[model samples]
Target: MRLSERLRGKRILITGVTGFVGEALLHRILADLPDTTVVALVRPKGSLSGRSRMEQVLNKKIFESSRNAAGGTTELLEQRIDVVEGDLSTIPGLPTGMDIVIHCAGDVSFDPPIDEAFRTNVLGTQQLLEKIEASSPDTHYVHVSTAYVSGRRRGAIPEGPVDHVVDWRTEAKWGQAMRDRVEETSRSPGILSKLRKEAEREHRRAGPITAAQDAERRRNEWVQKKLVEAGGERARSLGWTDVYTFTKAMGERVVEEFAQRMSVTVARPSIIESALETPHPGWIEGFKMADPLILAYGRGELPEFPASPDAIMDVVPVDHVVNAILAAAAESPEKGKPAYYHMASGARNPFTYAKVYEYIREYFDENPFDMSERGAVRLATWRFPGGERVERILAMSERAHKIAEYVVTHAPRGERIRKIAREVDQLQRRLEFLRRYMDLYRPYVEAELLFTDDRLMELYHRLEEADKEDFPFDTGIVDWRHYMVEVHCPNVTESMRKYDVIRRRRGRSAPTVAKELPESGEILAAFDMDGTLLSSNVIETYLWLRMPELDRTERVREIGTMLRKVPGFIRAERRDRGAFLRSVYRRYAGADLEELENIVDSVLAKHVLERVSAAALRQVRAHRAAGHRTVLITGAIRPLTRPLEPLFDEIVAAELATDDRGRCTGYLSGPPLVGESRAAWLIRYAGQHGFDLTKSYAYADSHSDLPMLEAVGRPVAVSPDVHLWRRARKGRWPVEEWKTSSAANRLAIPFADELPAERTS
Candidate 1:
């Protein structure tokens, strides 16, 4: 009988219809076995019901041909397929009288949390098998599993049950409890203290609120890392490669125990790639195992193939795997005994890592990836080093990149430093990705296992000649060079091209400002004073004020003193912005408060107003015209900021403490309006004045203003420094360059004479 003819009039239950392989299988059935009725078991996504989610799934491009073949998507869903609302986590009762069940769902992450792996792969499968035995005892079960269940063993693996002595029930229990244990250890005092220190170092300039959030984030990351490490250790101890395969093996044991009562067939496929012929050649949904490595090598990020040259790269096309699965489902084994099949290419027509590298190199050389201004990416000759040595090299490169990043980040701000910082950032991101890739894929690339697919081929030969022509599962006929270059390479590159365009669009599409400003008094517009609105910084303003009060020798001595302390100021600024401001203000010690006010009045016109950014002034005026409350929130001393008072409705500037004689005490009267304190103050002020923070706007340039910027709905980065620019880019916030006023524009400052008149009064 024809494969589709046997499947005709049968009722099938399929799981993981949303996943890549499951979706492809569903499409194949809908297109070929049009008479079969399918019940898809799906879990409700966030806001979508099961039926709605299935509708969305059918709308995917993979189902285009199937949809058209079945009259249309609506007709296919309404007349043929039924959506069952349930998940494997809690196995709802199976539909009655299922002729066949295709179990395709499991946690596919290579190193998921141990508990998740067990919950989805081991316990989930156990529940399904139990339910099947209870509700639909006569159903033929086809479980889709990976070929790598052979684990760390390196030899010719046969198509049969895995030999094991460990109790699967006990292993599942241990794996499920691993996360709780790791999380408890992560909460220990020593670990928390270490995480706290790291967080403070990274986010101190942003604020205490941000630092606390960072600490919590790091704690979660630590717990996750420990869980992954524990899972890997447990798997390796049990002779498995990862949590995925370990749990999968446990699932097979569950099936083995259930096989005494039910008919079962296990189909194991190795490294499924893009389609070769079925459903149109080269069709793919996402990048799979070898695609990342190939793309990385083509981009010149990976200079070496981290694998033995002679190791078999056992990859089979997805269409072949799908066909083999249908064939397995069609041939039901005798009750109380299960059949095993390996849908792989290694044992039939072996392809080595060396050949894969050569084919990919040839493809990329003919069709190179263009990198805009840098020209086309050139592929380098890759050395086939073993995984361990390559990992060690990557580790060394990461350490060196970290050192370079630290130096460049701390260096003085200039055009050259910015350029170097960008390069360092790119290298850091690339290194991080490469490290993660190596960690996840090292075992697979270095493995020496070759799966024998004799049983699978025998099943194919049993099919009638017409069935064989219509549904082919033989991997021996695939030309490795043609599949790698003509099919897989183009598919992966096209997917990557689409992703790159979407990523670039996301980075460039952040809205800079609202098209129409709402006229409301409850809306606030906050501006950082120095480096944001004006080109002058604290040091320059301090020099202009204090320099004229001293003799030539005293001026030289004061200048030398400030220059010597600049390095310390820079370090403090990076660690804590408030501390830096405090240290800088200490230079005002013993100077008369009245004298400083006088000096500011004299220098306020040429030294300060001339450096004001005309573009920033226009923004402030626009905010005022929109009936919004305008405020200047700065770390600069109050006396020096008095001249800019006319431009703001309120000024939250720092104040110096004075003694009975009215001389400066070189200390702030209260905490400086910087870092987290500024953010806290803004929140309190908003509460008191009934201002809506979600409608408020903030503009700043320094990293210290991150807290304030994040507090508002609209945050603009104005002439930002290296750290602030990077943060803005990460957050997709608008960045603007605010230039200093020209000589002609300086005379047009709003209420320029009002400050001197007020001081004289």
Candidate 2:
């Protein structure tokens, strides 16, 4: 029977229906063979319902052809397909009346944990075959495998069963053992913390902590590191590149053993990429085999890869693989007969690594990605360094990474400084992930194997004259240059751009500050926390009394640090109060952020809020009543002003730098809000929110606040310092003594007659 005719009315069951290959096959079958009923096996993903999963697959671009053909509606297409929510590894049997079973599901992670790969690939296949034999023994089973099942072999890899020496069952048992070992090593967070505390206590008994002690204190991290290393080592020792392919080889053996009693056609396709032609050209899903490297290089990120310039990469389009699978299923051999067909183009039409690199460079040169800051990225053919050299480069990069981490942790905090540090950290992370990906793929990209697809070609030639037009698997017809330049690269670049735009929108800030600002008639009141609204600075109080004295020496040292500031303060009284106050807070660099916040909460509840000036409180209440957006500007740390947060709409203050793990990193995130910095922040905030700065009000007592006071229309000097009193008089700003309510109604400082009439407080 002809391939297309054979598919009519056939009840076909396909696993991995949501995957790239499965998605393409569903479209092709629906569009070409309208009479067939496709029973798809879909596993429920996290939070996504089974129906939703099926809808998502059908919603992809590959299904557009089928949807358009079905009268611009998916109603008919949905009626023709049946979806079963089940797992082959644990589920009992296939849905009833299935004449063909196409198993396309398998773990594809390059470094998946050993047990998971075996469970999904080897054990799952065994269970599926047994269930199929019992339920539908005559079903034509099409087993989708990979061309890399040939392992570390060179020269020409033929279409046949893999000669793996290890028993499949033994390998599966080893997988279970590894999983058990990993589970045994895993410990709860509570247990880990308890052990860490004990380790710390033990280290305290010694003079100074050693590297071994530190490692012991971080037991969870050490165990995780060991497990990751063990997985790769275990796979290599078993003669497979990774746990993925190792388990896949074992799965092929499962099919081999089952074919002894039933018909099974194993189709091993080489690195399946986007569609070249069929439903649509340049159609692909998320970053596949070669895409990550290509994109990274285009962005001037990847410097080198582990592959020879002359190595032949066997790549086949998704449409060709889908065609071969359907054809094989229709013309499968008799029961108890098994066959192997390699789906590859390397043995026929080959593209060397050098040619791929040249094409990439040429394409990018013609049309480069528009990275505003980096300009247009130019491609340089990557160097194929030996394994040892790659390791050496990675070690050097690690050392540089360590130095960067230290610098970011120790640098002074400021908005720009913090931003640069975060960028550095993110770049390092990207480089590390790229390194792992390249290392895992090194064997395949650098392999010297040529895969022959004689069986696939023979089947293609046997198709009927009209069938050949619909199903073309001949690799010789593919134009490598045209596909790379006109189809594949453009698709990749467009996809990347779309993803970046979506990402930016998802992460974008809601509105600009200028847009949020009020009009000229609207009110905006800015207040200073330390010595303006509050009687004293909260941070100094914490340093003096709230700190725990570990010992007499520590207590004396803390006291001396405070005392040493007295001379500087005395000089700053005649010089710069901003410099003195900034110096005082620098001592808080090494304090634990969470612990400091807790201390602030306790101190606020105990005594800080009680010190708020009554007169200043009344004035703040009056401003709020007039519908003002109150802003609190302070040189102190953010946590110290938590008690007053409800009284203000916005707070601008100094920030503390924290590590990726959210621990204090002994540095400030940004500069303290003092002197002209406070004025600049207010101006920027007003511009962002569209506020009229000329109508805003500011209240402060220090001479360092002169710039901020001058920027606002209504500047008030509350209990003005000597220098500020003189400036308030010179600028004709109001001066008020915010004395206790019991003493008087409001006391105005005797400002020079040139000043604005002193306001009552």
Candidate 3:
């Protein structure tokens, strides 16, 4: 009988209908097997119901032809498809009299947390089989699995059950228990201490609340990372490539136990790529197994191939895999043992990594991806150094990227620094992506397994000529060079490039300022002095004011003294802004206060005013126009802040204590206005002035001002440092880049060339 004839009018239940394979299978059935009724088991997502989610899937471009054949998407769903709401973990009650159950749902992450892998693949499959036995014992079951379940085995692997001694139930139990073990290890004194120290480095200046929260977040991340590492190690120890394949093999064992009760078949396909013929050639959803490496090579991010050049890369088109699945579902095994079929290409027509690289290079060299201002991306001949050596090289590159980022991030703020920082960030992100890619794919790429498809080929031979024409899955027919160069590469690049454009647009659309402002006296707009209102920092401002007081030789000596302590001062600044301010201010001890005040007044026009940001001035003027009180809260000395007193209603700045002789003592008259102290002062000031903090705004550029920003309803980050930028992005706060006058770049400061390059906090 024809394959479509056998499936016509049959009631089939499908899981993972939203996934790539399941959706393509559904579309194929709807287009070929007329009168068939399919029940799709889908889990509810966020606010969308199962039916709504299925509707969205039907709206995809891949289903266009199927939808048109059924008159429309609504008609297709109503007349042929039924959406059931449940997942394999819960195993909802099956629809009555199911003729077949095609189980397609499984976690596909290469190294997911062990618990998650077992829950979705091993335990979920067991529950599903039990449900099938209780609901419809006569139903023919077809379990979709991966050919890589062969694991570390080499040579030709035939269609059969995996050889193993471990019990499936015990393994599932152990895998699920891995999470608790990893969590306990994460909380050990040594691990917890390391995590806490890293968190403090990132968030100490933001205050105790932010630091504590960051520490907890780091602990959770550490636990998750440990769980993934444990899963990978356990899989490798048991001879499997990763947690995904290990759990999948366990799932097969579970299915075998239920084989005696009913007719069953297991279809294991090799690495599935874009569609070859059905739903139009080159149809694809997201990046598949090999797409990431291919794209990385094309973008010139990966300098070398990590796989053995002579190793066969068994790849089959998604449409071929889907067809084989349907063919297997049609020919169910007789009652006792389940039939196993390998839907792969290596046994019939092998394609090697060298051939893949040759084709990819040819295609890319002829048609290169334009990298905007950098022109076309240049491709290089890869030296196939294998996975381990490539990983070592990637590690070295990552370290170099980190060092470059550190230098760029610490450079003095300017247009040049901003450009370099951006480039460094991009390079760092690419390196991290490549590292993760290698971690997940190294096992598969380096493996020497060759999957044989004897059972699948026999099944194809059994089909009538008409059935063979209607459903073709013979792997020998695939043309590697034509498919790789003409179909798959074009499809991936076209789809992924559009996604890149959309992502860039979304990144640039983050609002920099609030659109609406009320005209009320109770509202407040608070600003931070250095780096927010002006381009200058305390070090630069101090040099501009104090350098002229000494001769060139004395000035050089003073700069050398301060430069030696810059690293320690930076560390102290990260730990406590108050302490850093006190230490840096001590350099002014024994200097005349009258002379310092006079120098500050004299430099107001040429040095300070020229450094003021025009964007910040406009914001203050807008606040004043709206009848909102404006305040400048800073750790800069009172004398230095005196020039900006007229711009704000109040100026709260540090004041140096003096001795009876009127010489500077270099001691703050009060606690430094930073971190938690800044927040507390703002709260008290608001209470006394009758201002509503919930309706007010605060702006700053340093992580030390995190507490003050958190105290207000609307907080803005102005040209913020890396720490502040991360917090602002997480909180969905407004971020503005305020530029200072161009003349500020030419301001003369002592030892500008000799001081270690560093960014202002």
Candidate 4:
């Protein structure tokens, strides 16, 4: 069949669209069957990262061969796919006219809880089947089950029905509720009986089918050993080590029974290696054995293993599995019996795990990642057991954590304890100096010559049928070597980053540069306290901020209005056109800079309160009406800003400003920065004071006001001028106007304080 005819406007839905294998499957399916409509059933978390990841793979060069073979761009193929939000456990309210449903949503873990594992894999499959049976009964069911589900049996595990048995181990060992679930879940007679029943069901569903049905089977040893008491002894007697194989055994049994009525074909794919085509090369994510095996070889960990140097490990590319699935669906036998194909690797080209490791070693050396070898090791081992001996390594980590915690708590001597503590800390330095190998990375490299891809190649062949004529899904058209060499490797190599974290004693960092200005005996705050605090501008803040275009009359009137509202209050408009900025030294632009500081000391001593803001608290308290924390930051000396202190959790302002006579100067000396200057000052303040600027907020008026706005993670512009207005529009910032004196606002606030008027300049 032509690729287009194979699809022929067929509507299909596939799950796990974001995964490495899932992505490849979509590309291959769409590449071969151009007329098929593909929909991705993305998990909920898929919404978080957005489409960047999906796009990254689709944009690779490996698929160019696919394009040449199938002859189409990724964008052209993508237009056919629509993303759908759905998980295996949850049924999506899909449209009624769906044709085929492919259940590829599965966790790749060999070890998963039997119940939850089944819930996602087997049960999820059942749930999807239920949907098809109910909504789209005519929909064909194509399932991709792993080849390893053959249980750990030696020799050629035939492509046939899996033998299942009663899992008494699950029932006898788990809790009452868990046990009840096992009984609830066991719809099949048994694994062994279930496989035989599949043939019988096939005869009834259609006619007698020749192909053997595929069933999954395994013996869960991990669960029995750990969760179950005395599991070690039982596992030794039963001969199973991992729950993956054990649960898989049960899953195979489930499939045998479920496939009875549904058009099901299980593709038992063995150890899926990198990529076969579609997305290209090794477009894989997370850590696979190959990655670590190669990592170790580069650094030199394992030189050899127990396996034969040339024994074929039966590895197939993800693309091959997807192709097999597509093919099985296309070639549904007249007999309704579920077909199972054991996708094996050595059937064509024999390669060993040892050789695979060698290639990885060569790749690692040839393709070094960012960071030195130490960083590479860190990246290589970021899991529970990591790449080392699990139990031993965990014990060592616990010891280190315990020792670090103990040292931190034991340093409380007296006046001399502080000194002695510092001295004792030197021991860490000594220990570090003794450890020369710490910087050197570990070694245990695996060569890549072992990885072979014949099975995948077979799947890549797009061919014609007696009636179905055309190579629609052929990967032979793709350029695999070019892909693995150039494109896929770069994408995987540069995605993650690492950083160092340090612990410092609390309250010991230096004061922010802004905070230090007042104490430096420079600058001053000429606060015209009243109207500035009372103005509707401050209350409106981040929202509804419009920059005011001011003539000299308006600026002077604003200053005058503020002065009259608060007697004996210094008046300062938001500096730089309501920028709310001023120099740390109150350095007058182009003025004799030294003179300002010299005179500032004599002018600042008058303030008694710490920090003050009439509008901020009212707004916060209004938010309290809706429920929120209220805070304020100011440039006035502490005593001056202190009156509004109770209204806020934090009030960062100039420290107590003093004069030459050690008396109140009333001129408001010291660096009393406001607005953008306030924002810059805030950054230094956070660094010194250890504040969370990302979580904190600041409110101000005017365009120059934006610096302070930018400083805080949350910036609110209150009655800003033209500049801020232009910015907020371009930046798509939220805007709202809050009138402090408005009756509605006053009623909304829990504490009502009348705002002071603007002082005259």
Candidate 5:
């Protein structure tokens, strides 16, 4: 009999109907076997009602063709699918008289807390088994499990029951104990008091409490850390990579407990990806195991991957896995003896890491993801330098990331630049997370996990020719090269394209010129002072200059204050640079404004002017000669720009607020003109002074000046950063390199702070 013919008249209880596998199976069953009853268990998401959440799933594109063929209406779908509003963990029992129970839902997170993983994977499976025994004792149970339950083993993985070291009941008791401890410790007055006392002592030593909410946060953080450590250590001891797998193994053991009472089939699929043939090829939902890495590579964000070139990575098409699952469910195994099928491709059709790398290169080379207005990015050539090399690279990357973070934290504050720095920090942190993920999946990806699929192949052969066409489970028929290049790659790129994440990375073609330059010549020429005219940052130079004057006691106190702020400073910059810049400038409070101006003038004469970029200086002179209104725009305080103030017709920069005594109050009188803020300021200033912005010229060297560059008709980049360089190329903007290292070296200024050696500009 055909697969669909056999499925006809069956009442199936399907869990995880919103998941990739469950959704695909539902579509298959409803489209192929119209007579079958599909009862889907959908958990209410957040504030969404259960039926509302089910409607959301039904609206997915994967269900489009199925829905269209089956009456093509929501009412028809409502009639066909019985949506149950429930969770597997808490559900008392499923609907009675169900012919088949397909348990597809479980926690798939790699690092879920031990108790959470067990509660969802093990306890949930146990609950389902009991429900089946209570409501429908004769119903067949089809449990979808991952092949990685083999857990860090080598050679050919067998198609049979898994024999784990820990008893399922013992594991369950341990999980309960952990939960009890967590709840007990949370309410314990002694523990909470100790944590609060320690936090209070640390706060007293640090500084004045800036916010009350922060006071209780550290104590909670410390307590949570201890809980996580305890769970993580226990997970590791179970010989599994994470709590997810260990609990999944326990889940299988729970299934074994009911093997004698009913017919049970465990379908283990290895690294299931997008569908190959069924329900439309290359159809995938959400980011799966390797999708992030693939997307990152397409965007040129991923530079290196950690894996051995020749490692056999077992991957299976979603359709083929689903086919195996359905076929396994149909099989009549001997009573009290459950059937096991390994739904994988490695044993019959294998794709090595090297082959995958080659396929990706060829795919991108032929059909590069069109970032549209954003200039195209080339995917890096993946290098698989073995395990040791990967660790070495990670160590180097970590050190470099730390150094970059340090520079961003201490660098002179420019709101725009600070915002960009924060983005850089976030990207670096993501890279770090990816590196850790790579470590977690390294053994799985790099190992020779040759799964034997003899029983799966047998089931395929037994299917009639018509059934074979509709439900194909044979991986031997898949063309590895074609599937990787033409099928999988395009699917991933298409999905990411819809996401719009690829184009948002600093590349967009310049907008068309809207208005011509004013012919009568009321042109504004905006010059970015710090990196444009002045080779060094004035604020940083001033800080170094002032460092030597502090006494030992004052120096020690200041050092402690700065050290205590390092973590918050980095995080603040990442979250919001404007706020970070404001916080940074606030440190100058109580210093005499006039004294700082005098110091700025002396510094400009002795150190700043000579280091001014010769190329920039010439351009400024030319603008002045042309009768254009010259403006010096910098994030530095007004006093720091005083020495160079005479050269410009008007100065636009951050101003320090002064107290009644004329000392710095360390607050800005207005918004600091940095990054996009600079552009806003320029537009306002131009409107007030009757200067035509369309006729104006702007100069800057960083990506933060993107707004200013886009604001004016003629924008120039001088020794620009990487992001700006890419933007400039795409926008056809002028770029000039300036050299001022020798001029900077000519100064004999003494500095007390042991600053990192400066990079020559």
Candidate 6:
């Protein structure tokens, strides 16, 4: 489609420039078209906040692909791309004299209120129109709209403006969803409340589940909760599922109202999925509910889902949406009637829901992660009398009620299937227990929503037609089938890799992380809790090292080991009825803080010799020699106290609680010092005594420490984790990598038997 002509030297402005779809459009425009200038209008923010999400979007190919589907990459387009802060609701002043203005900004809500849809979509368009009119520039405006404007049309809805009467059928179908949302909201005070309730209730049922399950359970406990959450019912009725589109319908109407006098074109695409064509294929990001659901189902996350295998699910790639939008805008006549572009088709290319499932399943087979299979006997779900799959699913639902019936009547790790049953039942019970006592965010996943993707074909074909030379569109060069399987799949995995930690950052100020700690009448040299001294991961600690002799097994595990104990650890839990736990509870009920400290000190002084990083310790003593007060301001607990004590003047381990007698009774008396809390304490200690945190230096390995890291005058992250690493890169924090055990570190090790000479932290 001759995209070369329209894109030549065009200056375009885009709203929602940082949004999922907007980013795609921006990327496409930037990468494909030469001499094109794209200006982005983003919602503003304060300083010291998360770096522009645009960076995250731009950096990742998955994000880039998604953005490409809507548009091309601004960075690659070789055009001057300017990001201007603004929102759709209010049109902030834009740079004057733009050749093409794509108002891709609108309230993209799933179930927006009629008034809000009018205000943000319609009124927002009105505001943009007014702004453009006032400027009186030779700008061709392209408004991104949705294909759902059919408003509940039963048959295949065509593209273009039609005076189709909006009757009771449309209103009734859409109205049901709103009513359901209202009903759901009425049940719970808030969204979190509902999720928590569902989680709590699900926590009681028998099944292997994640946090989402518990949340679903809590929400489902109330029958009406599902019905009230907007698009569930209405989505299915319209042959296009999900609430997002329903709200978008209102947006389309708004565009129609405001596009009359403007040089506008409306691009209506349905269920804009990942990129079909662009720099890459199937490049998707954002771990939406879909991924979790799929992963869970694959890992037996849910007992069953109510869905029709035969239901048609059509999705257009992001680039097609972008292609149609760009070409239509380029083809727009002066003062056009909002050039309507339907971005759906089945004319020649037919991608079915069943085929999609097959493709996804095959992709999983080839690009498998370290997903563990059910380890034992298969979980035996309810056996339905009817042979049909639907009947079986329904039967399982009924049986799920009695999920906990066997918990009181089973052995640990029974049969594999039984184990699953036990696990789900136990998890649900634990969830219930926690919900009854702990402060938790409740999440409710509404059920009973029928979602569809009927007009997807019509939209795609229209977009394909727009791609023809008459209108002209080019989605760069992307392979759809392979892209989805290989490209997008890996992108999702990588983003979620190591819990979504892109990279770790090392900050400046290595010397600030002191070896010698501060004590009374001593120069303090403190090491950061996470990175400089100990490894960044605590979970890895327990996993790699043997649990303390006492903490060998859950039965005998010490409440507080080397690390300072949290308040909750000290409190006796009554969830278990086992005598073994009860006996331990009695032992922990009355513990002396001083005695506990002594126990931890002995372990730190002897057993846990491997915990200290020798090179870091050597650096500590050098500070002491240099007359700096060496202090160990760590998040470590008593027993897990490190090996480099003598180098420091005093060790400020995480604070612990004490009994009246001060013997090691086992429970913590107070809060543990860690992260920001630890920072706060350090600030107070320095202010009251004679320390200057700002002038002093700090070291760590986690990005979560960004707040505390900044508080210190010098922030250094050695061997940083992903978050910290990213910050270090962005904030330009200096990083140093060194071995923990060095020959010069001999003087730093307080104990004779330190971590093996060759061992490194």
Candidate 1 wrong stretches, greater than 4 Å: 65-72, 501-522, 586-589, 625-628, 659-661, 687-692, 739-761
Question: How do all models score by TM-score?
Answer: 0.93, 0.69, 0.87, 0.47, 0.66, 0.50
lDDT of each: 0.85, 0.73, 0.85, 0.46, 0.74, 0.50
Clashing residue pairs in candidate 3 are: none
Cα shift from native, residue 715, model 6 (Å) = 21
For this target, which candidate reaches the highest TM-score against the unseen true structure? 1
* Candidate 6: stretches off by over 4 Å: 48-79, 107-122, 162-243, 285-305, 333-336, 346-348, 372-483, 497-761
Off by over 4 Å in 2: 68-74, 188-229, 502-761
Clashes of each: 0, 15, 0, 106, 0, 102
| Cα lDDT of model 1 by residue, 1-761, tens digit | 98889999999999998887888888888878888989999999899988888988898877787777767878779988988898999778878899999999999899998888889998999899888888889999999999998899888899999988878899888887888788888889999999999888878888877888989999999888888888889999999989889989889988888887889999899999889987779877777888888888777788776888888889999888888899999989998889999999988798998899999999999888766566888787878867778888888988999899788767766556767887889898788778878888888888888898888888999999997887888989999999999988988898676776776676557547665678998999999998898877787777766766676688779889988988887788878888888888888899899878876776555567778888888899899999999999998898888788789999999899999999999999999988877788899999999999999999998888888998998889987878877888788788788888566343232222334555435
How well is each residue in 170-268 modelled by candidate 6, as lDDT tens digits? Answer: 453445445556545645658757666554332211112333454655554444434423344554454333444544564455556556566767677
Residues 1-761, candidate 5: write the lDDT tens digits: 88877887888889988888988888788767788888888888899966787788777776776667765647646668787888877775578888888899998877665677778899989988998899988889999988888876778889987656688888777875776687577558776676566544333211123112234575456445555555557766876666677788889988987988888888889888988987787888877887777777777776777778888768789988877778777775654898888888888888888888888888878877666665677788877877777678778878877887667644654444546665766678667766767766876776767889998888889999988887888888889888888888888778677667534542343332223333345898898876778776543554543544466687668767876887897666444445766887888788877766655554445466777877667777777777888899887777767767667998987888999999778798887776667888899988998988877888887666777878898888776655565567667777677667573674354343333233111
Q: How does model 5 fare in lDDT?
A: 0.74
- The segments of candidate 4 whose C-alpha lies over 4 angstroms from its true place after superposition are 2-4, 46-79, 82-84, 93-97, 113-115, 167-241, 292-313, 334-336, 369-761
The alpha-carbon lDDT assigned to residue 323 of candidate 1 equals 87
Worst 10 residues of 6 by lDDT: 439-448
> Which tens-of-lDDT digit does each residue in 513-581 have in candidate 2?
122334333667899877788666533554533354134577567767767777666565334444555
**What overall lDDT, based on C-alpha atoms, would model 2 receive against the true structure?**
0.73
In what order do the candidates fall by TM-score, top score first? 1, 3, 2, 5, 6, 4
Off by over 4 Å in 5: 69-73, 176-233, 369-375, 415-423, 500-761
Candidate 5 displacement at residue 54 in angstroms: 1.6
Shift of residue 313 alpha carbon in model 6, Å: 1.7
Tell me the tens digit of each residue's lDDT in model 3 across 513-615.
7555689999989999999998877776667666757767888887898788888987788688888889888878887888677666654544677778888
Per-residue lDDT tens digits for candidate 4, residues 1-761, read 55456567888877776675677677766566667777667665544532444454455664565456544555544567666656788866655677777767685664344455556665566567777778776667667676555543445556666554556336223322443443333334564355445433322111112112322211123233233323223322343333444445445656566566666666776666566443544556565534443433344343333333444555555655665667665654322587676655554444444455444444555665434424543223222222244334434644675586355434321324333433434544333322211211111111122222343344444345531222233323434334333443443443432211111221134111121211211111111222234342222211111112234464457445544643222122221222132321221222222322322222211121112243444555554343233445554435434345555655665543335545433333454554435556667756665556665555554444455565555555543333454445445453334334433232121111111123112
